[model samples]
Target: MNVLRVAVSAALLLSNAFAAAVPSIKYCQNPRAVNTDYVGRDKNVLVQYTACDGVATTQIARAIEARQSNNVCGAPYNTSCFTPSGGGPDPNDCHVITDALLYDSQNIGALFTLDPAQNTSLITMTYQSCESFMVNQDNVALTYCRTDWASILDNLAFNCQATQNAHGGLSVATDQEWFIQVQHS
Candidate 1:
């Protein structure tokens, strides 16, 4: 009972703090567009804004929070480990992913999960085991940054096929995962 009370109090305090920190926001027909413009502007400027059609105030706050959490360069989907909160581009979290902006990035606005990371680790372990076997036999570990199998081995390692192939300096069976090229490697 005491723990529950403490939890409730903590929740209220955090909620209030979040409410205080967030900028003034409104829901409108084009909240997504408005938000895009707002976030893209110079940081010195302070302005309250809306998002695209169906985007809600909550989502706007959530997006801002996600960006703030990243606290680094680039927006969600454009960078790694940064998952955009709220679904896709709309203010409405309920909006179907396909209906999102053509620029919709962030793993197709899929929520971040550990599966891809785990897959990469698994594939890397397998590759390493193979490497050890080959190296013990006096074979040079032949590899290319082949990202073609990034998503297969670990979605987080590389996004698209192009990213995989062009992932300069990435390991094949070494420190990094070379999942697709496992057979060839």
Candidate 2:
């Protein structure tokens, strides 16, 4: 019994350490436009914000929390959703993403920045992931069977849109310079 207890305790410690190593990513929406119908389909206008700097991440979290509201909207397909909180054109909205393959940039060593014009590939990936999350919010098994595939595509269509529409009315020029990209040697 004592040996079993020790093994269980060791497992718990290892699990905690693994959890600690995982980064925390915050998903925040454009507060002004929690959900928008852009190009004839409704999409949750959200962004994935995170940082390598602990202080900056904490500050961003606080800023978002300060503006967060409990008001849930039955949106897209009558599902409950929360309002997005963030500063309008706020500096805190920008966070660093490490090990990113940025497009059209001379930088190397895996530094990625959100460039509205040049980072089309990364943007496409983000949109795809967001749509996946929206469609599988309940963690349901997705099927590609002929009859179900159409409905799945419809959900993806209704929930996904261009990222340009998600940025609280910020122009492309502004978004171009919004994030600070750094490549580490």
**What is the lDDT of every predicted structure here?**
0.20, 0.20
* Residue pairs with backbone atoms closer than 3 Å in model 2 (clashes): none
Error of 1 at 19 (Å): 29
TM-score per candidate: 0.13, 0.15
Candidate 2, 1-185: lDDT as tens digits: 32223222322322221122211212211111112221101222222322122222246554454333221112122211111322112211111111011211223222222211111111111221222111111111111121122233233233222322221111111212111111000
Backbone N/Cα/C clashes per model: 12, 0
RMSD of 1: 22.2
Task: Give the runs in model 1 whose Cα sits over 4 Å from its true position.
Answer: 1-31, 36-50, 54-159, 163-185
TM-score of 2: 0.15
- Kindly state the number of residue pairs that clash in model 2: 0
